[model samples]
Target: MVATTGRGRQGRGRQKIEMKPIQKETARQVCFSKRCAGVFKKASELSVLCGAEIAVLAFSPSSKPFSYGHPSVESILERFFGSSADAAPATPPRHPPAAVLIQALGRQEKELQERLEAGKRRKAALEESLRGPQWGPVGDLLGAWRS
Candidate 1:
């Protein structure tokens, strides 16, 4: 049997990285470029596979903006905001007047706000669960455990 040296294969495998800001500017730029490309690729794949509209905006270390959007960024933004500048004025309203449209939009906004609040609550509960139990005293723990 041949003796094996631990050092031989140790550095060749993947290692868990500590989550922290990269110090060197060059390394940070390289990492940013690679990660940005990877994210954009994933976004593209998700859009294609799920038929979902997507828009991604990112800023580099130098404060330059990068964006990717399916079916054009401007079109997506217009759709999201429910406004379009180039829309033909000659086209007759399929629905009613501006007041009805405004009312409908208000209702939609309210519904979206309610959903947002619910999602925030859910997120907070999940975060609390992940943090485990927090007890000030034995009484608190017992009270929580019992109920």
Candidate 2:
């Protein structure tokens, strides 16, 4: 039965797009977001259907982690690996105060600036010492200065 045409498309022309690497970074990120959501949804469905304890952890191209876990990852890991893996660092709250963060950052920046200036002074002293014998020997000089 060589009756030509009609592969159930109502005689419409269909263009087959070859899967290729996305050129633009933004476009790739958007595509990754869409596809990551789709995959997570599928994983959720599969876990529900098969009644299986499952986990899927993925990293985006930018190295950000995205994960899906059924019946809690902590419980599942405890059942298999051990409870030791549950020693996670304390997480920040859902929202933090901007003023508090800014103040903390300011304090850190000031401390770092002071340290940097101290380091620069130490470096200059070392360089000056290296320039001539008048600055004297270099045996534990920095340590001596610290004391």
Candidate 3:
């Protein structure tokens, strides 16, 4: 068998290509799809391991939109608004009309209240579980077993 020569300029053979921006249309499209999938996968792993809420919005080269959210994009966005509103100053920003500002603040407030109630309920359940008689006193366990 004859030995093959070195890589040609067209790169017909697989040569180490640069990681720079892809110039060719077809190659760029393929790269975009692959990279987007990788980004979403990494984001999923990050949220699962860290218990983090994440939301991602991406626009493809063709102006197509895509999204990835752990839990949900809406929930994460609502939490963000609730946290931001909590830290906001008394004076509302001048850009948006007062009516819009008031409406947004009201929504954020409602969401914050719901979140707080949920937390309180969870705490109550946990506390009640701790007080349960599942594994009462060791002496009681021994006495009951003996009887």
Candidate 4:
């Protein structure tokens, strides 16, 4: 079996091991403990190096909770989960002027009505055309108007 080490500088001192089923379980527990400690250590190092607050939480294989924070966990928790007083309440979006909206609606309605009437006329013309010589006289009249 191949062994794989953890990533990052925090994992520098740790070594990977290969083992069987029972040994794998033991190795897993040991790795988890070491990695968890490394994670907390890195968090602490980051907070100190950057002068930034940090919080971390993890649960072990046994379901026991572990946590770490710089400058108090509650402060970080409050900053994370608490709402700021400076935040503005969300407001409904404003619309265009009522006059402009009404005008646009009226223009759209007129265009749609014109299109409907033109479609009806086109359908009637097609039906007449399909009826053969019944539309001959109308066609002749329109041909004369075109001339």
lDDT value, candidate 1, whole model: 0.80
TM-score of every candidate: 0.47, 0.42, 0.44, 0.42
Worst 10 residues of 4 by lDDT: 86-95
Stronger candidate by TM-score (1 vs 4): 1
Tens-place lDDT per residue, model 4, 12-126, is: 3456655544346676688779989999999999988886778898997768899998776766777677688554323222357899999999999999999999999999999
Give Cα-based local distance difference scores for all models.
0.80, 0.76, 0.80, 0.78
lDDT of 4: 0.78
Candidate 3 vs. true structure, TM-score: 0.44
Candidate 2, backbone clash total: 0
Give the runs in model 2 whose Cα sits over 4 Å from its true position. Answer: 1-17, 78-147
> Model 1 misses residue 109 by how many Å?
49
Residues 1-147 of candidate 3: C-alpha lDDT, one tens digit per residue: 333556533323555667788778888889889989999999999988886778888998888998898778776666677757666433333268889989999999999999999999999999998887666698688879999
36 in model 3: Cα distance from truth in Å?
0.6
The alpha-carbon root-mean-square deviation between model 3 and the true structure, to one decimal in Å, is: 16.3
- Candidate 3's C-alpha runs over 4 A off are 1-19, 82-147
